[model samples]
Target: MRHKCRIAQLGLPADQRKALLRNLTTELIRHGQITISQARAKALRKEVERIITLAKDGSLASRRQALGYVYDKKLVHVLFAQAPERYGNRNGGYTRIIRTVNRRGDNAKMAVIELV
Candidate 1:
């Protein structure tokens, strides 16, 4: 039984999956939005939100944690600097995902994931 298995494997091995999510999260933080496959967007949403939440903490430990996950050190510094002001009043729901048309070649459902 696949009960309570909420995490999506996304057809990738564990290492690849983590790498994909980490890269997606970094780009989302850098660009504010990105268009990607729906399944990937869904999985990426969780990671992005978690990192933003850590940024909200604005603590040395939280910053270190985020730095560990994010690929770019400079980007992490920028994010930590801006996140408090940007997300200070808000709580959670830092990202929004909007469904878009399917890809032409693969017909995969696509969506735009953006920071809110």
Candidate 2:
């Protein structure tokens, strides 16, 4: 019954899913890349792109919005400071997801999600 539903549940409750994405987004912004489950990478892509778009905006409201979602204030500041020059020419698609080998234990598909 997916119908018009688009959000991936990731088999987690709302709060946990938000927290997981928040952590992943924070680490991705901090390190510029991260390895994660394919499903999570897919989900994280949307959030990262949205946040970077906000950073690109570089408005006080947008910065506040990004700060609310991103856990690290310093990282948000850096991202906002750099986003315009780094991504000015680009419209969207701020991240790339490269499929990697399956996990050793459960065979879950893994992927490296990195900033473009």
Candidate 3:
């Protein structure tokens, strides 16, 4: 049984997966939207939501923590500065994934992940 093995390997080695996620997270935050595979979107949703949650706190430590995962310092600043105010009235569910057409070649499932 695959009990408690929660992390999605994403069919990549550990370092590569981490790098991919970090890049995706930065793009999502900077652009407020991204289109990718369904599996990647699902995995990224968890990460982005967690980062937004940290941003909601607006603490120094939280900012540092988010900075660690996110590559751009300016993006992290934007996240901590704007995200809290934007999402202050709400509880959670910062992002949404909308199903979209599959790729032409591989026919892979696709989705648009956007910040809500």
How close to the true structure is residue 80 of candidate 2, measured as C-alpha lDDT? 94
Give the runs in model 2 whose Cα sits over 4 Å from its true position. Answer: none
Q: Candidate 3 lDDT, tens digit per residue, 1-116?
A: 88999988999999999999999999999999999999999999989999999999988999999999999999999888898679999888899999999999999999999999
Model 3 steric clash pairs:
none
- Candidate 1 stretches greater than 4 Å from native: none
Q: Which tens-of-lDDT digit does each residue in 32-76 have in candidate 2?
A: 999999999999999999999999999999999999999999999
How high is each candidate's TM-score?
0.97, 0.97, 0.95
Candidate that scores best on lDDT = 2
Instruction: Tell me the lDDT of model 1 at 94.
Output: 96
How do all the candidates rank in terms of lDDT, highest first?
2, 1, 3
lDDT of 1 by residue, 47-109 (tens): 999999999998999999999999999999999899999999998999999999999999999
Q: How close is candidate 3 to the true structure, as a TM-score?
A: 0.95
Instruction: Output the lDDT of residue 104, model 3.
Output: 94
